[model samples]
Structures are given as structure tokens and as C-alpha cells.
Target: MVNDMDNIAGTLQQSLIQIITSVLTVIGVFILMLTISWKLTIIALVTIPLSILVVAFVAPTSQRLFGRQQAALGKINDQVEETYAAHTIVRTFNKEEDEEKEFNRRNHQYYQSAWKAQFFSSLMMPMMIFIRNVGYLVVAVVGAIQVIHGQITLGNVQAFLQYTNQFSQPIAQIANLSNTIQQTIASAERIFEVLDEPEMDDKIKETPVLAGKNLPKVEFKDIQFSYTDEPLIQDFNLKAPRDKMVAIVGPTSAGKTTIINLLERFYDPQGGHVYLDGQDIGSMTRDDLRKHIAIVLQDTWLFTGTIFENIKYGNENASDEEVYHAAKMARADAFIRELPDGYQTVPDESASNISQGQRQLLTIARAFLADPEILILDEATSSVDTRTEVLIQEAMNALQQERTSFVVAHRLSTIRKADQIVVVNHGKIIETGNHESLMNQKGFYAALYNSQFAGN
Candidate 1:
């Protein structure tokens, strides 16, 4: 996208002036040629059609090749980004050679498309020059014949030839511009495709009435959703009361995260509705809805900034004192203060400067700063050690005091104390009860939970 934008910008800045200049020069020279010798002017004008033919033949091919080149360039960018981001994993798995081979393949694809595009575009200028020279030779011969027959003065014939040369100069200039024009069109096509895509639905208005005495903090009603054409979740319904911790657990591909995604409005259900505080979530603007929720994912995201800035990202208006307090609550303050620059320490681009657990702690601190009405922890403690996990669990218990919390966890021990344990399998809720009740029932949840500790 960046490369394409640069191409578009350059074309607009330079080609606009060149086009205007060429058009005016072509018109001015054509009139001069006609006034000097109309007969010779006719001969000069004949070559214009041939020049047009050359451009017609080459310009479309150049555009298509440039489009292919841009697509290949995009693939190269993706390859480099993925390879570097997963550099440690690749080295650990001894797959460096595989990564290098993939990168080389993408690079070669880019080279192939780029070479063809440039070669075709470069053909236009020389082709135009050849056609113009042919017209020049014919015009010169005819002009001399007119001069010999006393039909025109030698000076006039000479001036007409000069005018013919001037006329073809602009034509050649426009022909040369065809290359840049084709590239710009290819770039603009890509940009416009993105710009013209349908925007996410933001049609909801009017705050939902939360006047009911005991409305659920979050509720999903007869929900149906799927990432693909096949249904993944169907007829899913849940009512999570305010100030309660709801734990969702199941085997892999059990649509555990899909439930959270629906509540977060990341993907709206194809059917039914999600309500927050008695108002249909779909009837609320995403910004308005998201302001009430905070989520910490398994993969922590932090930019290259100080610990203070990273925590303050959740609430930009938060004071330095608030950031410090949030970090302390998340148990991140002690380690952060021990660092060389404490809160001022800048993390690397990938935040690899800090341990994985520390990165997770920073994200939790960020969530604390958000102070949202709802909290979501999706495998948030997965990266930490047992000791760190206990600290996080303690911090989370404190953070979940008043807010409704949803914990998607694989370690059943972490969510054993949840107010509600919802076991899902193949998208349907198979069991709903507290840990004690579910364990006593000896259902799927009990079997799954007991299996974890069976070996331990």
C-alpha cells in the first residue's frame, strides 16, 4: 500500500504538468504547420494515428503487468514481515532455510513481474520516436517538392519542417508519459478498491434503556455465527449478570472465543442479538459499546514506548499517578521500577526487551487503567509461571470487583471459583453451573477438569 501510494503521488505531482504542457504544445505546433504548408501538414498529421496505435497496443499491456508487479511486491512485503516477526520461532525449529527459500521465491516473483512491466513501458518512447522519424522523413521530402514547384517559399517549407518537428516533440512527450500514467492507474486501482469497500455497520443510535431493576450486564439471545459459510455457533443464549465472573471452557475448536467475540462486537451474529444493559448491542455505535469493555488477549500488543505510555494507552487521559497505581494493582510496578529506567524504559518494536510475562502484565495494567464496565481475559495468564499466574489471579480478582468479567481459560484450576462455568462443545453450551456443582454432576466439564489433574 505504501509503495503504491508513492507511485500515485509521484504521477500526480509530475505528470499533471507534463500532460498540460504537451497538449498545449501539440495544438500550437499543429496550427503553425498548417499555416506554412497545408499539404505537408496533412502528411505530418498521418503519423499521429500510427503513434496512437503504438500507445494503444503497449499501454494496456503495461498497466496489466504493473498491476501484477504491485501484487507480487505486496507478497514480498508479507513474506518479510512474517519471517522477521517469527524469527525466533523459525530458529528454534531449525526452519531458517525454509523461511529463506520462501522469501527468495517471493522476491523472484516480484523481479519477474517488475522486469516485464518496465520492459513493456520502456518500449513506448522508442516506438514513438521511430514513428515520428518516419513522418519527418516523408514531410521533409514533400516540403522540398512543394518548394521546387514554386507552390511555397523555401523559407516557408523550412519553417514548416521545424513546426513538424515541434509537433512530434509533444506527441513523443505524451508517449513517454504513458508509462507513468499506466503505473499510476494500477496504483490508483488498488487504493480505490480499499477506499471503496463497504464500511462496517455503524447504524445504531439512541442509548438503550437500562431502567430494568436487574438486567443482565451482557446477554446473547438465540445467536448464530460462523467465520465461514458453515455454522459454528447456533441458537446460543447466555445471560451474564452484573458483577459476576463467567468462565467459558471447552476443548479446542469449541467456539469458546467466538462467544467473547460476539459480545465484543468483533463479529456480529447472523441472527439474534447481543444486549448490554438491556440495550441491543447492534443498536449502539461500536465506539460507544467498546468504551464499556476491556479485553486482554493471549497475544499481548505493545508499541515501542515507555511502560508509562504503554499503560496509559488504555486511557490516554489517565494521570501519571493513575498509571502507576494501575501497574501496581496489576503487580507490574515492582518489576518495572527495577528496570534501568523504570517507567521511562522503552520497549523494543516487538516488546522482546521485556519477558513474555512482563508483557502480559503491562497489558493487564492497561486494562486496569481502562476501568471498563466489563472485563475479558482470554488466556491472559497463559505466558506466566505458576507464581506469576497466582499474582495475576489475585490482581484480576481485585479488578473484577464491580465489573462483569468473562474468563476464557484452558487451565480449569484458574476458573474453578467463577460464579458461572459454561462448558461449550461444538458451539452449544453443554453445561452451565458453578465449579462445585459442575464437578459434582460429573458431566463433560467434570470429566475435562478431572482429566487435567489426573496425571498431576
Candidate 2:
């Protein structure tokens, strides 16, 4: 709130300075006009004030038009960014011409709004000049009459003409200043809109102790959640023993990933509570809860860095030997050695230099180095080749030995060896058992499994 107040005060000060400077410049011009003839000074004073009044009346309308133009430009930028980010998807879906048309439509709208604003703003200067010129003509005629009648000297008439030019200068400056002030105001409003948005409450009130000697079980009791008003999961419950493998299987949008998000506290659940060793997850610091968990997402994201750096992201202080061991355990060492620079080879921006399988292996290596007590593998091997999948499976088997692991995958083959498989449908756990037991039940799990292995 204090920051907001400071920003508002700063903007007001700047705008006031601009307006005051413009008015002061006009007063300086009026002073020069007085050196002319008193008759011409009277004419100059009336015209200058009238021009200012006209501009003051028009300024608000011009601001509104300019604001609309700026908003249109912002929308065009958003569309361009979206189009570039989804360029591959757009091309794959043959949306090139369609996207081009949409872009053109938005571009045209921006052009129209910008041109309209310029049209109005441009009128101010020309209109001011025309009105000032008429006043100058009137002064010239009146001064000539006065000189002829011996009321004013010829030198005085010349001086009055010079003063008329001086007076017009400030009027022109004021018009430009008015336009600038409107633009500054428009920009401030947009900036403040973002600053005024509601931020998520991220403060932590307490910290939990995490150590090798005392690891606690994770429990979910009567948990319900939703991204919107409609609940995704209701009355959901689960308990993960300190060191056990729990595989959650579900069809698309059955809320499998939502559980992982809840566990990580990316979002708080709408109802019930998540407990870690009987302590509410919300009550504990978010960082403390996440320190014990290591997740390998399906869509692996590799920063533009060497394989060694990417893996070391999990633990910045990890020793070189620990990093090498983790890579070897994930079966990523073989590929790293094949590269020209081995572990030092820099990855491309989108990691296009490496195969999808290699990228997944690198992510897995990162998780291994973190040495987290709780592991989450979300479709970890879905994008890899069969041979690579088998290698990762072996690595995962070794890594899952002492940690509580949660595996979420659509590939039925991957979780066959899991200690327990919980089948979920419509955000509810419809079946829970081992591979053979779930198959014997002959429900959703059996049908899904049969559909995949029927040809085999």
C-alpha cells in the first residue's frame, strides 16, 4: 500500500510539473507581447486564453481515444506472443492461414484505433495556429490604423508583431504538453492495474524439522479440490507410508496430476486436510514440505546449459562424484559420453539437440541427485523409446528402494511391479490393488489393461 501511494504521488507530481511548465512558458510569451503596443497586447491576451480553454476541453476526449489505441496494441502483442509459443502446434494442425487471418484482424484493429487517436491529437496544433493567426491579423489591422492616426509609433507596431509571434510559441508548447500528459496518465493506469491485482498469500508461519533419522508418513484425509467452483475430487483419502511405492493410475482428467499439485501445495485444497506426520500441510512452511519431495514431470524442461548443470539444479552444492553417480544410475552416462563435450555439452534452447529419451534421463538424474525422501514420477517414461523406458525403469527400481514413491502413468506396463496401484475415474479412486489383483477384479483397470495388451 505504501508503494502504491508513492507511485500515485510520483505520477501526480510529474503531471503537475508538465502542466505548470507549459503555463509558465505561455506567461513568458505574454510578457514579450506587452513590449509590443498595448492595443496588440490586448488582442494577444484574449486569443491565447481562448486557445488554452479550447484545448483543455478537448484533452479528455483525446485521452480516451489514445487509451483505446494503447489497449488495442496490448491485445495485438498478446496474440503475437501466443502465436509464436504455439507455432509448432499451429503448423501441425494446419492453422497457418487461419492464424494469419486472426493476426491481420487484430493488426487492422490496432491500426484503426491508432490512426483515430492521431487524427484527434493532430487537430490541436493546427487549430491553435489558425486561431492565433486570426488574432495576429486583427492586431496588424488595428495597429496600422493606430499608426496612421498617430496613436502608436511605427516602431511600436513592429515590436507588437514580434510579441504576437512570441505569444503563439507557448500556446504550441502547451498543446504538445497536454498530449504528453494524457499519454503518461494512460500508461500509469495500465501499470497500476497489474500492481493492484490480488497476490497469493505465501507467508509461512512455522517450519518443520526434516532429517534422516525421523521421516514421517504423508496422509490425505477427506480431501476435496477443484480449480473452479465444480469440485474435481471429493472426499479423497490416501496414506503413503514413510518408505513405500504408491502408484496412482487414472484415465485422462481423472485428477491424477491434481493430487501431485496438492501434495506440492501448488494450490491449497478446498476441503479437508493433507497431513505430513500428523501435521497439517498448510500449517507447515511450503518450502519445508517441498524439501522432502522430488518430482520428474512428463514434459521435461532442460535449461540452456550442460547436462551436468541441469542435473546439479536439484542440489547446487552436490559434489561432482555425486552428480556422476546420479547420471550413471539413471543410465544417462552412456549418452553423455557419446556427446562431443560429454557432460559439458551445452543443450539447445528447447533441448532439441538431445533426444526426448535423453532429456527424460537427464531429468531423472536430477531427481536422483536431490536424494529426496518422497519421489514423484509423472508419466516419467511416456515419451521415451522402449529400450530407454526399460533402462529408466531399472534406474527407478534402484532409486525407489528406500523412499516413498508415487508414480502416475497411463502406460499400464510401467506400474506392473508397483507395490500398489490405485485406479481412479471421475476424480475418485474406484479400485485399489496390485497388478494381478486389479486384473482379477475386472473393472476399469482390467478393461484398460486388456485394451492395451490385447494384441500382445
Candidate 3:
């Protein structure tokens, strides 16, 4: 599988050049051989179909074997990735030998399938050579009889022999690349599948929403969306005016994140529209729309780069002082300074170099540097302790002071001060009000809040 990917870069280059040059050579030589002797030309032409029949018979078996080999390789890769990610757990449980045995089993399966694919494909070239050799024998016997009758000159027979070799040469080359052709066909199939997929339609992109507004009110009007057979959001509606913190509290898979996906245009509603400043969001360039919004999700994504670079990523033009101030606001500056190179330290891809709480802090700091007009905090403080969450809440309050914000929280305590708290159950809104109003009403929000404080 590694070899397949390594060769992917050059597969088209070598195969195309070989096929084109070979085809052109065959065409030129074919006409010349015909003029030498129709009898000999017919013999060469017969070999063409015979060569094709050989490939047609052998190539499918090779392709099937290749597919099996790839699947086996994928399984081995999955096992290796799992072992690598959980190497510490394996050592803790003393399961390293067991893991090695499973890995060896998958490796052996891959070896068997890979050899079979190669062995079947390898038979094509030898069969092609045999076909051409038989054509050689036929040409020699027939040309000799014709030469004896002086029907064609000795030079013509000699030239025809040369033509015969040339005619079969391309066929031989193509046959030798049967395995490559099969792999190319398989790769092309997968690529075409993606290319043929449905894409977003933007008929209104010519005219944008929010032409002059840096910040616009967001609205979901009669929204209907679904991922599976049933609709997740049926007749959903909401209006979030500018400079207000709207908190959405719900149980797991209550469509909290799905709402975020719609706001960011990751998935368009199956029906109805999401509007910004009274205009449909579909009317704006998605990139232009997203530039005004900043999101800090629960899963903090930190790439392999310096801390300074990661902070600067939210706004490349941000001044060094701006990055420091943002970090301070998010309360990430203290731990960052404790690092060896501070802002210059490079983290691993998984960001395992830092604790999960620190990773969340850096992400929040990065979002602060963006200074966007709209903000999304999707369980942004979930990884932190209660004390740290309280600290981050202060930073979030400062960030949301003059921007429209949406906060999805599982912990009921985080949204106590929000201007409006929305309670979601299943796929629909169950309650909507402030912390005071919802508590006064004694509804779902009150129940949820009471459950949190029950022990106390």
C-alpha cells in the first residue's frame, strides 16, 4: 500500500508516455506492414486481438487480488495506528506481545495477496511474447512461398519481418504494464466517484448579504435539515441579534453542534434558509462570510508549529503585542512563559506536549486574536477545571461584549449570565428565556439547573 501511494505521483507520467509512443509506433508500422504483404499484415492483426484476449482473461484476476491486498494493507495500517496511539496503554497492561502477534497476522495476509496480484499480472507479458513468436513462424513460412513465386521481393519479406517485430513491440510493452493499467483504472474509479458527488449550489452568490455591516444579526427561518432518514431540525427558527450572548444547552446529540454547522455553512438546510442581516447567507461568498466569524470548538486543533505561529494564524497581520495580550486575556500566557522557548516552542501534531486544558487555552487565545464580529464557543471550556472555567468565563465575557455569540454547553452553570438561554431536547427547542426567567417558569431549564445544584 505504501508502494502504491509512493508511485501515485509518477503513475500517470510513465503510463501515458509509454501508451502514446507505443500507439503511434504501432500505427505507423501497421500501414507499412500492410503494404509489404496483405497476408503478413492479416497475421499481425490477428495477433492484436489474441493479445487483447490474453489481457482480458488475466487482468481482472490481478485487479481483484490487488484490491484484496489493498484492503489487507488498510487493516494492517489501522492496527498499527491504534497500537501507536495506545502504546502507553499496551505497556501498562503488558499486551505488547499480543499486539505484535495481531500485527504479524495482518502483515502475512497482505504479503499473500500482494504476491498473488503480482504473479497473475506477470503471466500476461510471457503470453504476449508467445503470441508474437507464433506470428513470426507464420510470417516466415508464408513469406517464403510468396518469395519463391516472386509475388513479393526478398527485401519486402525482410522488411515485413522488421515490421512484424515493430508491430508486436508496442503490444508487448502494453502487456508488460497490465498491472499498472489495472491500478490506474482502480485509482481513476475512486477519483471519479468524488468528482461526481453533489456540491453546494450558490445561485445568489453574485449579490452578498451584509454588504456594509461588519456584524450582522443571524436568523434561522423555517429551517429544516436532516442527516439520516429522519429530519434532525424540522421547522427550526431563531433570531440572534448583534452583540448578545445566546447560550444553547442540551444533552448529547441534541443537535447543538448541527446548528453550528449550519451557521458556518458547513451544511445547507434541506429546506428554508439561514439569513444574515435579513439577507440569505447563501447569497454571500462563504469565505467572505466566515471571515467575520471565529469558532473555538471542544476539539482543539493545534498543528505542528511554534506557539507564536499558531496564535498568529487567527490573524497573520496581528502585532506581537496583540498576540501577548490575547494570550493574557485567555489566561494561557502564564504556562506559555514557563516553556523553554515560550512562544517559540513547537508542539506535536496531537499537542501531547501540553495538557488538554492548556491546549484549550491556546485555542481560545487564538480566537481572541481573530477579533471577529461573530463568535462560537462550542464547549470551549469542557477540558478545564471549574476554577479554570471561571477564569475563561471572564475572558469570554470580554470577547462577547460587542459581538454576536453562540455558546453550546452541556454544563448548565456556564450560561447562567447569558442574555438568552435556549434549552433543546431531542431535535427541538423545549425552553427559551434568561437564567431568571427560565427558573421562574419552572420548565426544562429550571429542572436542568436544579439537577446540577442538587448535591449542594
The lDDT for every candidate, in the order shown, is 0.90, 0.84, 0.85
What is the per-residue lDDT of model 2 for residues 328-418, given as tens digits with 9 covering 90 to 100? 9988999899999999999988788899988998988999999998999999998888998998888888888899999999899999988
True-vs-predicted CA distance for residue 262, candidate 3, Å: 1.5
Clash count, predicted structure 1: 0
| TM-score to native of every candidate shown | 0.90, 0.77, 0.86
Selected candidate, larger lDDT, 1 vs 3:
1
Q: What does candidate 3's lDDT look like per residue over 150-258, in tens digits?
A: 8999999998998999899898998888788876665554445667898776555443454565544888878888999887988888878789999999888889999
Which pairs of residues have clashing backbones in candidate 2?
Answer: none
Q: Residue pairs in steric clash, candidate 1?
A: none
Once fitted onto the true fold, the runs of candidate 1 whose alpha carbons sit more than 4 angstroms away are 13-17, 27-43, 100-108, 149-151, 205-212
Greater-TM-score candidate between 1 and 3: 1
Higher-scoring candidate on lDDT, 1 or 2:
1
Task: Give the winner by TM-score: 2 or 3.
Answer: 3
Largest lDDT belongs to which candidate? Answer: 1
Give Cα distance to truth, residue 390, candidate 1, Å: 1.9
User: For candidate 1, lDDT tens digit of each residue in 210-282?
Assistant: 5768889898889999999989999999999999999999999999999998888888889988889899888
Give residue 107's error in model 3 in angstroms.
Answer: 6.0
